[model samples]
Target: MIFMTVICTNGFSRPNTDPTASQQRTSILVLNLMPNKQGTEDQIISLFEETNLPIALTFMYPKSHVWRHGDQADLAENYVSLDDISDQYFDGLLVTGAPLEKLDFDDVDFWSEFNAIRDWSQTHTTTQLFTCWSAQAALYTDFRLPKINLEDKIFGVFENQLLGTSLPQWFQIPQSRFSAVDRTDVLNCPAVSILGDNQATGPFILKANNQNTLYVLGHPEYNADTLSTEYYRDLEKHQPVKAPENISLTAPQFAYAHWRCCSRYLYQEWVKQSFLLKENNSHEQKQLQF
Candidate 1:
């Protein structure tokens, strides 16, 4: 019987340990760039727990970024600074999406720091997972792919067709973005493969040919109310935002999470692949010692 465990030093919930299970816990370092720090933490931690794998999570924030929302004291106490983990290693790295999609890559305050972390991850981490804007950032940095701004935001629950058999044939994924990478550019790049695609949203999931990196272009980790929250938040702020498609504004409860299963499947697959890569590397090291 496989047992899952999540160890977070912060004040988050910790599950009971199983004595029978004996597996090396995978360490995942998350560089969360989201404005709602606590909400993003909850969403990511819940996803890791559902994977049923022994995992240890370490949350990180950029020192170069200025905090506008949330308590600064809590951040300093709970999350590690970039300088804190510069010499550390992890089995996996997860970089969350930020709200900096509207600005040019070079215009962001932490662009240099972000690039430093991205470059560091290449050698320090075994596997990397990037979501939403971070996915766009990775594509731009690695492939020089430009982001095309849409006249309207792709805000809604979208049904995406899976190009690979790793996940279900079709699944719903939530998208809330004003920019996207060109599909032709992604297809033209030989080093990347599109795992999932949507008719309106273009490529939803992409993987590097070497299998060390995964890019998720949508918010599969989003809660049922996430879209609704964003919609109302924008309206309250008087931003030029339209109502999210395929979701009812009158009855927000109708936004059932149809993509939860797919989200779990995708995360579990990533963990499994990371473990496989670790094992193969270990085997190679032992062979070389002979």
Candidate 2:
């Protein structure tokens, strides 16, 4: 059985609770696909912090040496493992993209583990969010769509994501690198909807399966310098890379004007919609007392 617990540290302070009236908060499992455990945790935790929603976070890693990158041993210092979904049924899931861009996901050793998690999530999780590679993984698992490859890596804040009428309030695409392995023909699935897209960014943000699974093709959970760090690191390694175009290093002097406003509106709308979920998802672990 999976042991259940809340990630309480930093500012996540929980006091005495009103058992009956308490809301059941969402459990977000950061299936950190990035091999660098510590770094990935830093990037992912920020998203939960932003939501201001009472949440419990757990991290999962693929075991065995099958196509793993970075170093999992280093990540083990802070990471934890669990065996089952009974730990606590989650309301949402966040899956990260990995650095492995050159291999087919199915060929990778962790493919089966990811497949199992994806399958379990469909019925167990209320909503799921996949980032970059995980987005591709989920797309393939649920709909058998493959990611399209690009000759050039799409880096930086190239604004193409937009919020539509149906978008939730808490949804926001923070500017980051959207290095996609490929694209899939989404037209065949009526349950899938695009929240953000750029021919350059591909499907930057999207919602699938009646909003149960929210798929973000980019890394909005990234820190301000996350893109810059990756860019500089790649350049140092002499790997092919590009600068993120049109993001503010300082306060804005010049802006895209129209595109900026549109993106802002999309973010605002998401925040509005997200509030309700935040309210409803905050739950107490034990049964109501009063």
Candidate 3:
């Protein structure tokens, strides 16, 4: 098993729990699909630290895809192969977005492996969170929805309004994708609850059965300059992109990230709900025994 230890030092402390005692830790597996695996890892670790939940985060990479970003040797040493962890169950699963939004789901290099992982998640994980392309893939694979290609890339900080749920009212999140899930297709899914959405971006967050899974279309965990970095990279490549809204392209250094607050809230809520569901299920099993 890939073990991850992260220290939470953001003023939140668990004073009641004894340091020597074997506290129950939430096990979360992250399927890292981003080319910049290190960057994505850092972002998630930083965000989860605020929740103060004891988390054993195992990083999983697709063995089928030819990794191109970091040294293969280093990745092998640090991360677990997706196939190796397929049999193991976890309290939570997080699937990151890849840059393969334009390609059909079946056309991606690691599509078969991803599909297998998706199948494993249905029974293995208590709660699953799918981001960006992964979210689109979930909608397509699990719900038989089609991903709609946008006229232009949705690359900016857009507003998302919560749909009268336990989630926060409204927030802005960074979006960088070539395609989006059809709003109509999502509405047809009987098990999904639209937690949040945006006018331009269609749907932002979809919760399956209010407990099993969540799909986030935008990158809420994005750092302040993630959008700026993408914009500059696109500019260098001459890939027709625009500056992120509410951020000054002339001076991105001074821009503040307001999304981190909501992002933390989203994850914290998921972790909290997952634990509650586990506890409730355990209690139900105990009752059945009697």
Candidate 4:
């Protein structure tokens, strides 16, 4: 059997020429909230590719959200709305981070719609993975946890200690966020487990809902220069952003990706766990019929 990444946009046909082979591929729906749509697609697809998993991808965006960075026509053509896939069930759901950290969750324009999609995932998807802001958002929506604005953005790569047995003892992850969930609240919560954390970045990874949902507060899928690009972009926009910390001083323009190994391991584990959960659920349903 050949293993390849098959990416299909909304209303688009699967590119896998072999119809029978497509039936065996895992389906993952990505809610791309990042401003750079294509870039985020490449990063996510790369992670799955490294796992060597035969998967079919469907990219979707909130219809309530207005296009700001990319072309509206392109997004309308390439992305699906939550309503479009209301009847479908996915093996996995990936929610990308947005740049709206400073605003309250209720203040975001698509806040209601975001909650709708999040609610839908509870029943429609087997496993859900939330990154960065979406991670914080999930904590808020489910646990009543509040996000605290950092005095300074937690920008740059930092080594995180794994709190669970799923990953290595230590792994570096790239963080670029203006806020974080309260560690005390997470510690007090009963539904969630802190999987990985850093002293500076608080809880970097969390799992809840019987490990069916995963939250990553940093960008593990980030490329080597993602942080550098953000740093320079902020400067150009005259945003009050500091130079990313923990990067080489002499060559700040290029940041090395010390997090790729951990990133791949994380995604691989998630996919494996997702498949197991799906199978177990399917078996449970069959038993219920008897």
Best by lDDT: 4
| Candidates ranked, most accurate by lDDT first | 4, 1, 3, 2
Question: Between 1 and 3, whose TM-score is larger?
Answer: 1
Clash number by candidate, in order? 0, 22, 0, 0
- In order of TM-score, best first, we have 4, 1, 3, 2
lDDT of 1 at 205: 80
**Per-model TM values vs. the true structure:** 0.88, 0.71, 0.85, 0.88
Q: Write the per-residue lDDT of candidate 2 for residues 114-204, one digit (tens) a residue.
A: 8877877665665566877787778778767776665677665655444452544333344444345233577566767665666556666
Candidate 1's residue-wise lDDT over 1-290, tens digit each?
33446666442234224433323678788898988888888898887788888877778898888879977777777788779889988878899899878999999898898889989998887888899999998888877878887888989877667655454556667789998888898889998887777878888787777547888887767887888889989999999998888888766545544677778877787777667766677522321110
State how far residue 196 of model 4 sits from its true place (Å): 1.0
**Candidate 2, position 200, lDDT:** 59
List of clashing residue pairs for candidate 1: none
Best by TM-score: 4
Write one digit per residue (lDDT tens) for candidate 3, span 1-290: 22233432111122123343323777788888889987887788877877777775778888888888767777765677766676777778989999998898888998898888888887788778899999989878787878888768887867666556656556666789989877787888886777777777888788766347788897867887788889989899998887777677666444444677778778888887777766776522321110
How much is 177 displaced in model 3, in angstroms?
Answer: 0.7
Displacement of the residue 60 alpha carbon in candidate 2, Å: 1.5
Off by over 4 Å in 1: 1-4, 11-23, 162-165, 249-255, 282-290
Model 2 residue 275 distance off true place after TM-score fit, in angstroms? 10
**Which structure is stronger by lDDT: 3 or 4?**
4
Ten-residue region with minimum lDDT total, candidate 2: 8-17
